[model samples]
Target: MSQLDAIYQLHPKRYRDKIEEESNYASIENQKQAVLSIGSLGVAICSLIIFLIPYSTTIRGVIAALALPIVYFSFPYIAISVAAERRRKEMERVLPDALLLISTNIKSGTSINRAFLASSREEFGPLEDELRTTAIEISGGKSVQEALDNLRKRVNSGLFQDTLKVLSDAIESGGNTAELLESSAEDIRTSLELREEVKSSIRMYTIFIVMAAVFGAPILFSITVYMAETTTQMWSQTDLSGEASSFASGGSTGLSFEQPDVNTDFLVQFSILALTITNFFASLIISQISNGNMKEGAKYIPFTVSISVGLFLAVKTLLGSFL
Candidate 1:
């Protein structure tokens, strides 16, 4: 057997089924193999590059070790999830049009199978391809319900699945399939429009979240750091020697403030940590507002981190130059 088959066998049955359902590829085993191969190669290359960086050996080794597993495991999952999301979005985008076309065909006195076959046009994208396959399956002696069920399984889209269930029921019950298709198409279009309006309405909240996490937090933290550093410097240069002598001679009350032992390095590190965590959740919130899925926020993480950190460093430099 091939390596892909071996890997497929090693995975649990449920996971294999999920991979097959989500992926657009013809073969689940090949998709898994591609994911694994690409992930492993990417991790290996990254680890080597990290090792060659001009850092302490212990620090470099620690980073490499921690990154290896995260990259190896997450890259494949991320790739698969992104691919699935794109496929689902494409299907959702064109589904209403495909439905209307099928409805039109059926209204023009075509059989249900022929309506589906007629609607398999290039303009429908992946939905067209799926319809073509379903038509072929029905032509090859499978029942219409069975072929549609298979189409539902292969597409793995909730909207499409729900439409298929309705279509299947209508077909089995001798209902008006054309009317059902038209109604389903209208509902899907209304849903898509409502989603877009909701997203637009939440744009303000998304902007607020991003500003608070990336700009507001970083600016506040930088100002705090600057104030702390200034206080420490000013205290260090104070005439504390005279205060100590006066306290010894009872010239004044023995109350003298000493320089705070706040480590600037620790403050900088904490600021970075705070910014990262804030931006991470902020991205999640934005995703939830816009897409209703927290996982969709993953793509924003790198952007959030880079922008927040860059702004922080820039603010620090600007403040340092003035101070």
Candidate 2:
């Protein structure tokens, strides 16, 4: 057995439906195995590099162990989710045109199967594949309702599923299929336009979230670190001068004070953790505002965290050089 088949056979039901729906052409098991294998390999390499860093052995070991498992599990899910979303978007974009075409063909006295076959154009992209598959299934002795229901099951979009249901009901009721399809097409188009308007209306909020996560937070943290470092240096100098004065005054000056040890490394590590967490949540919020799904925002986390950490380091370095 192939590696993918072996792995999938071990647990066939784990994410099987989602994997099948999201993967356009590849076998679901193969897609799952590819994602898991590549993700694990990449995470292992990164863990090795991290282990080589100057962190304490226990901290590095903990990070490596935690990060590897998290990445291994998360990468496959994220990959599949993203693929599903892209497929949904493509389907949505072409759905109106496909519906209109099918409706026009039906109006021209073409049967439902012929209408779907005629409407399955290359311009429809993924929707075309689904339409062609449905037509083929109907031609091969499958009932029209069963073929259409199967098509709906294969698609991940709620709008497309609803459209299929309306079409199926119209067909069953012997209603005006062409008119119902035309109406459904119009409604889908209107809904898509309204969603676009909503996204545009909330554009400013998205921008603000990105700015706060990537730039504002980093600058503030950099300034705090700079201030802490300056305070530590000042306190060290004060202690040295106070000791000198006390020694010069035959140890009677009484001006010595214990300096607090502010660990810069700890502060830097804390700042990184804080910024990562802050940007992760910020990305989720942005995703929710734009797409109404927080999981859709997970893809933005890496970019947000990378930019925030890079800006933090750059600002820290610039301030260190100047201050």
Best by the TM-score measure: 2
Give one digit per residue, the lDDT tens place, for model 1 in 58-170. Answer: 98889888888787766666667666676778889999999999999999999778888999999877778889889889988999999999988776578889999999999
RMSD of each: 3.3, 2.8
Which 10 consecutive positions of candidate 1 have the poorest summed lDDT? 21-30
Query: How high is the lDDT of residue 143 in model 1?
Result: 98
Off by over 4 Å in 2: 9-29, 45-49, 239-255
Q: Any residue pairs clashing in model 2, and if so which? A: none
Candidate 1 has what TM-score? Answer: 0.85
Model 2 superposed RMSD (Cα): 2.8
What are the lDDT figures for the candidates, one per model? 0.82, 0.84
